[model samples]
Target chain A: MKGKTIIKRYPALLIQGGRTQKVEDWVAVEGSYELYLNDTLVDTIVVSPTDLEAHALGYLVTEGFLKPEEVTGVEQQGDQIFVRTATKKIIPRKAAHQNVIYRRREWGEIPVVSSTLEVSPALIIQCAQQIPEHSESWKKTGGIHCSVLFDQEGRVIKAAEDIGRWNTVDKIVGYALLHRIPLTKKILGCSGRQPEGMVLKAARAQIPIVVTKAAVIDRGIEVAERLGVTLIGFAREDRFTIYAHPERVRVAFSPHLR
Target chain B: MKGKTIIKRYPALLIQGGRTQKVEDWVAVEGSYELYLNDTLVDTIVVSPTDLEAHALGYLVTEGFLKPEEVTGVEQQGDQIFVRTATKKIIPRKAAHQNVIYRRREWGEIPVVSSTLEVSPALIIQCAQQIPEHSESWKKTGGIHCSVLFDQEGRVIKAAEDIGRWNTVDKIVGYALLHRIPLTKKILGCSGRQPEGMVLKAARAQIPIVVTKAAVIDRGIEVAERLGVTLIGFAREDRFTIYAHPERVRVAFSPHLR
Candidate 1:
């Protein structure tokens, strides 16, 4: 690990129990990073200072701007990232920006996920609970969101943390792609709420199962249902709710149901 | 109050304590909205379906795309919002998109807030605690983020909620602008993390104080300090952390210190 700086000390007044004290607080670091794809300024992201390459790659892959295998090289300077892809085609500038808030209808039909990966409820619960343990920056600053990737056998492949919830998901996606970890049979665990953007990221990346320790919005359910992705929300303390494609999760049969 | 549909019922599987049952769950609604300023397509937003007008106005104001007073009329047709501003000048197409993830360095100098408003910690704590009460959508779906605007005397001016965190802040800003509520002496309470982009919104809108029930990152503090905005974080249960400009919050003198 490069151990990029993710937290900084700041002065703060802590008020508690009718008393106030000045103290040095640990705060998560956030900065604007310029991302260049094939020598073109594609976009800028205000994200945690670390994991610039992963952020760039993940953003490109999940946004349909570029596929993971298409990338030829990646280089990061002070606050700018330059990525060289194998293709010589120029991406429409309008499409690059518009895709940030992409409308499902305008984007045409999204390919439905066809992964047949199956995992037990216990495995998902374990992954969701393990999110906090893998988040070092979050432990230090209490301001970061984390996402973890697990292989088919419930083994951790990699994890990422960012000040932005969506960035964490992109970081993990970028990490998996950079390390050549196949996403088809993996489970994604996030420490943020499940929204349409997040669920769509998993669907686009072909990650069949997504579990979160937070709530899932209506569009998240709709997108997950339409794209054939399994979404689990409110996954904590050994319980969870499956909003879509619950068949991917194996639930034990109980005689009380009869 | 114009009530747009903010929640929808969805089918889900509730799993708890070694049991799983099929149930209907209430989820917060999210949709894609097109925003046109002066007959020019500006941007698209993925936000909650309710409060479309406020969302459009707030987004334009906080993003530095248009001044609130410059807006002559606003119309909502289903999923699209048409905003007619008084100014005839066309907004640069590139500026509209690039500003979404703006780099402070590239945006030139930001106006420093000069408000001298002061309030007691009790008022802020009250405002922070009131966030949950004003969040009707949150109580129903548990997926929405709420932003509340309070006047100098701690009276609630308006509150708004959305599936996206930043949209809540923009909605309230738009609400204040629509109703001609001055933001100079107002306090904004948010139910989401404080980041640089969020702090910049308060600064650009001239809201002097910002309090949140969530954590504040380092860039949020940097922006608040530079822009002369009072920033508070982790404001819950009568305790709060003042991340920047602590002087705006008056602390009562206690003899125990002597």
Candidate 2:
């Protein structure tokens, strides 16, 4: 459980109804943590400050840096994560400063999401309602973005909440990899906008259905459609928009009927 | 305008009332844009894909990469942003991947925000209502984050909308720097969570007040208090929670009176 990685209390003035009242409320704490590969700085993340090992591992795995078992061990300092893999490689100076934004035309060629799991609307709404309950930080600060990996029966596999939506997804992925929780047939649910990066991460994991309580961006829809991953957005208690394969969701989504 | 960086249309399947419907809607287009510093890769960003110059300038300035003026010119190709700074320095390998997460212990040493502008609650509420009108992408995809720099009389100085909240702030900051828009005594309003990173960006610019339609995390409050900036969160049509510096707001946010 990567819950309440950091939370601090502060007195706030709630000005409403023409009245001012002071109340103590919990606020999400964000800290910057550095990740080092072979003692060379690779990345820095500002998060709710929980799950450093998992974050480092997941980030490495997703960024194509390292495989799960390839890493011998991970060490952590105050705000730094050190991952020692089997081979130590110094990142090329030119590549080190490469801040890149990329989209591949061939990403949709082969979709790994071949799960036959049937996720009903009830199941999605049930999970969307339960997403906030899994995070103490979100309840306290209303400031966290949460991601939960759930089994077919609504059992939460691994849950992670972070101020950065990407970190939350990374935490979940790391938890799954470390615990060996299968992702292929699982449902990934989150409370943040689904951009292409988020969709790409889930698609890479072959997560069948990605559900959210927020809006789905245009690229998110494209990636999901191309990757054969089902993307459900604005997943309120009763309604949801499926951008990709709805047949796999046990619902007949008729785009032509409209 | 950075408006419609990319908008793609796709047929979507809708499920509600135990019914199936198909519809066509506008989806946000996200692409990976490689940022270059004199033909050297600096960073990559996946965004809905508008406002390359603003995004490049804003990202450079906020990330402490370079001052806006240091950038001599900007060139864009399909999905690449090439920033030509005063000098093409090969960032030392060590400094290349230097990911920094910074928190200042003494951010309130001297309040950069000494503006006497008394913002009425009505003004904040009015701006909150007006923020939605600024972004066409948000309306279409329901997937964009928008920010506005508003004046004392409720005139919007610069407004930006992006898939990344950070990028949205950078766009606004870049607009200000490019157009020489005055930030002091102005209000910066956004539609995302007020985390420390966002707050620090505003504080660094000496913006007196920062408001959001979302919640403020604890780190955001601390940063605002220490940086002599007023932070207003959970701002809705008629109400908002003032986390730090309420006197600057016309409403009596008396933290000491309690």
DockQ of each: 0.04, 0.04
Task: Please give the lDDT score at residue A224 for candidate 2.
Answer: 73
**Candidate 1 residue-wise lDDT, B167-241, digit = tens:** 566557645643557778899999987666678777767789999898765556767888888887777775776
Model 2, stretches more than 4 Å misplaced? Answer: A1-111, A253-258, B1-111, B252-258
Residue pairs with backbone overlap in model 1: none
Query: In candidate 1, residue A9 scores what lDDT?
Result: 43
TM-score of each: 0.60, 0.58
Interface RMSD of 1: 19.9
**lDDT digits (tens) for residues B1-258 of candidate 2:** 234434333332222222323434332233345667777776564332344554454444433355444667777776677778677744332332212112122344434556777777778777777787886556655666688889888888767655556546655654564355667878888988765657766776667888888876556666777777778776776566666776666543233311
Estimate, for each residue in A96-151, the C-alpha lDDT of model 1 and write its tens digit.
55222222222135568899898876787778789889865566556766778888
Off by over 4 Å in 1: A1-109, A252-258, B1-108, B252-258
Best by TM-score: 1
